[model samples]
Target chain A: MPFIKVRDDLCKGCKLCITFCPKQVIRMSDRLNPKGYYVAELFDKEGCTGCGICARMCPDVAISVYREDKKEVPA
Target chain B: MKVVYERPESLLDVPFTYCPGCTHGIIHRMVADTLDDLGIRERTIGVSPVGCSVFAYEFFNCDMVAAAHGRAPAVATGIKRVHPDKIVFTYQGDGDLAAIGTAEIIHAAARGENITVIFANNVIYGMTGGQMAPTTLIGQKTDTTPYGRSVEANGHPIRVCELLSSLDGVAYLERVSTHDPKHVLKAQKAIKKAFQYQVDGKGFTLIELLSTCPSNWGMNPLDSLKWLEESMLPYYKPGVYKDIG
Candidate 1:
């Protein structure tokens, strides 16, 4: 599974990620956090490619991207 | 398989928009490569200025802000103040820094803003159609200086690193160029040192990059690089003006 995390407090709400993501998995969350800036959220993880576009586009260094890889064991 | 020199992991795979043979691309690559090497990409916030590199906000692949005109230093100050723990730097061009934003840079250094400034001094206003800039050589001609810059009228080019090193607030200052591969590597080292100073909680740091504007200079890319080596480097030699470390 691939997941994206946004440090809500650090987000400046530049909206650059929305424009750069190829999967369009990211969108401005409807709810405004305490900072009054719209936080970025992943609308669908199934479409995420773990390309790390959202993390790259963030101007505040507020996001982190992670992907889980499973190693198969010989039966 | 042969090894390839790939783009830095800190930089996106997107192609740059700079003109062919423009040194901004080289400097940008150096900065990105340095960030990747230092493992600071995740904590970096780059402030892009208004000049040929104005769209640097797109190229860095890190958190970046667009500063008005030459006010990158001012914007960077705010970002650094709010997030003192985060690494902050500014990418600026000659017209953006030395011409319109000179006062801002000077004050930022004087105040010891604890940020890195990557100043690309191409000696002409590139984005605005190649106007004579503060760093333009004494006899260099541009759109604004049709008959070449007269020393009596335009004055001599400002030695920014030399001037900034004289200040007590600045912890590091270096002038470098990207007209050649060897010098490109040297400039990269200087840029890395500037960022390292800020990360170490040292005061202000600035790296003046002597870049080439081939399209604006009306010369082919190779010729422009040659001119930069034979003419520009002679006037603006590369060196570390100040390094506390």
Candidate 2:
């Protein structure tokens, strides 16, 4: 399964990722960062195909996407 | 796990100072990604302009130089001339490029300087509280043009890519926007191409990005993106205006 990690300290809560994500996997969380900005979180983990559009759209570079390595899987 | 997307190595770990939803961070990442993709991060020297991105020196992991307001092209020219083997690039905003540093950029392109310029045109001066820029469209309301820009008073908005297209020295010129993911991806490709041109010894490649200034534009991030698409796109068409390669 693919997943994204959001760096809470870096996110400005601009919601750009939320706006541009085709899967609508991200949303502005109620929790605020140290800067008082409500950071975005991955709300729909199953919907994320790990396309990385949110990471690309993120101005703060707060999101990092990771996917399972097929080559590392046991046969 | 395999890392699919993350911060480019050419960018430092420090946070950007741009306002929330400001596209400067996006543009910076694209440039950094290009530097990393070209494997020129070690040999790349970036010239920071005096605008909202004035602190760009601190963000890019490569060697950076701070130039006088609108004088980034001039400084980049000097660096490229001295260190021809090193890839030199200038990151500038509208007020810095189209307004005060017009002569520097024009002459640099006219002289066929081999340097990459990432010109971010947000239509308004973001650092200076939404002042009208040379690229500000007519009827656009800015701090300086509270009643909307008038052609008679503000003259006319400068079309930089079109203006520089006729220059014989220009190797590549493209105008792109970062309003949506699709456009942002295209803009990234344009940035990579401009840097590739520089690596190939092509002269004077510039990628003009239509950026958004949400704080200065007095709109939320989403609204500002819409405004950029609806208002700025027709005036500054997004396409390759010139390509010699």
Candidate 3:
């Protein structure tokens, strides 16, 4: 399944990623980073299609999306 | 796993200093991504302007020069002329570009300098606190215009793309927004094209990005995006104002 990684230290909790995620997979976590801002987390891993929209909308460049490559798998 | 989206190598690992929800980070990433995609990061020299993005030199991985207030275009011109092979670009905000540096930008475009300019228009002066800017909308309340900007007092918002388009030296000019993901993608495309034009030795290229200043605008990050779409979009219609190739 495709998934995303959020850099907690870099996330400013602006929620742009949460707002733009078409799948509603991201949410603001109760925990705050060292900077005292809430960081975004992937709540529904299965719902994400790894479209990378969150990464694109992220102003902090804190999100990165990854997906399994089918082409590299054995036929 | 294959990486679908990650930070571009052209950007430094440091977190941006922009306030929470500010769109400068997004525009910075797009420019860095363009540098990475064009494989010109090593040969690229960026001119950092005054305002909120003054520290842009520290964020971008390539060589950077901090220009005097509103002198980014002039600085970029000198750099491009000295190193014709190097891809030179200037990152400037509205206050720096449309206000103090108006003469520099206009003359650079008029001269058809082989350089790229990334103009960020947030309607208000971001760094020095929210004040009336050259691009400030009519009836928009800012620190200077508490009651809202008035045509009789502030005149009208300057449309940089429209003004620069008429110059024969311009090779490409486009105005884009960053209110949504779709528009952000379009902005990236426009940025990449502008850089491509520079690489091809085309005359001056500029891409105007409609950006947001959440802190100065006194709105949450999400609300600022909404404000940009609702208030800014109608006045600054996003589209290609000029393109030579």
Candidate 4:
């Protein structure tokens, strides 16, 4: 389950999160947001360890992370 | 939900290189916990000084920059100015801030730089062996001061907060200690206020933390903390020296 969502509007295109993601899941996209900042895109949600490092280093409150109950079955 | 104390996500999983019972970890925790509560962990830029706490760059999971000896304030100033919206702060130990970096911090506050400073005062230089520092109390004995610090020879310990608080540009100043649980809690409150003051667009903020360096002090952790209370606290009482917030 993808828990970390990057708010395009607030992203400053710093790419710090991309550099710090231990899972190598976040990357800068070619598509620029309205603010002209490159939005970070997540390639794999399942690989996320819920470390929240990306959320902690975003420089902007652009990322939100949540953990899904592992016991829950898919609908 | 059960609550438990743990390292913040903004901190790395790597073990700290600091010595056992060093108060740097406690100061690190205070800053990280503040970031967690303010939900600004992602946006914080931590600047590391050149002394013992220099490796703080590795411990913090957030964006961190290692500044030259006693020059964290200068580096932090640049970062904050370039990224005005980002939460910028510098963590410096006694020698780094109160000694060589003294001019940098004074001018930064004089310029009213919108940044936060976390100053750890352990009285002695921990990394380069226990040398006397500007914050070392008079009559304190160290490797450099084998016969005890003489006021005539070294002068008195600098009162950093008092000096900074008198500056017109300063918006927040607090002196706290990490020696005990009670003081630790109070220090956290002051640390939170320092960060919050920065976020609120207030002027320069500095949190002077009276810390203990057991290894450098040539004493056990418990005795060092006790020395901090009995010897250091009287000279540097914990309180908000100035608060515009």
Residue runs of model 2 more than 4 Å from their true location after superposition: A69-75
| Candidate RMSDs in order | 12.3, 2.3, 2.1, 13.2
Cα lDDT tens digits for candidate 2, A1-75: 788999999999999898888888898899988899988999888877788888888989889988886443233
Considering the two chains of model 4, state its CAPRI-style docking category.
incorrect
DockQ of 4: 0.02
Q: What lDDT tens digits, residue by residue, belong to model 2 across residues B1-245?
A: 78877999999999999998999999999999888888999999999999899999999999999999989999999999999999999999999999999999999999999999999999998888989999999999888999999988889999999999999999999999999989999999999999998999989999999999999889999999999999999999999999997
Which scores higher on TM-score, 1 or 2?
Answer: 2
Q: Return the candidate ranking by lDDT, descending.
A: 3, 2, 4, 1
User: Residues B161-219, candidate 4, lDDT per residue (tens digit)?
Assistant: 99888888899999998766567778889989989989999989999999888898988
Q: Which ten residues in a row have the lowest lDDT in candidate 3 chain B?
A: B1-10
TM-score of each: 0.75, 0.97, 0.98, 0.76
Classified by CAPRI criteria, candidate 1 counts as incorrect
**Total clashes for model 3:** 0
Candidate 1 per-residue C-alpha lDDT over B1-245 given as tens digits, one digit per residue, 9 for 90 to 100: 11123356776755566664566766787789789988999999999998888888887889999989989999999999999999999999988898889899999999999999999988899988989999998788899999999998888898898888878889999898776546766887898888888889999999998878877899865677778888888888888898887
When just chain B is superposed on the true chain B, each candidate scores a TM-score of: 0.97, 0.99, 0.99, 0.98
Off by over 4 Å in 3: A70-75
Check candidate 1 and list the clashing pairs.
A59-B63
Cα lDDT tens digits, model 3, B1-245, are 87878999999999999999999999999999999999999999999999999999999999999999999999999999999999999999999999999999999999999999999999999999999999999999999999999999989899999999889999999999999988999999999999999999988999999999999899999999999999999999999999988
Interface RMSD of 1: 13.1
DockQ of each two-chain model:
0.02, 0.77, 0.83, 0.02
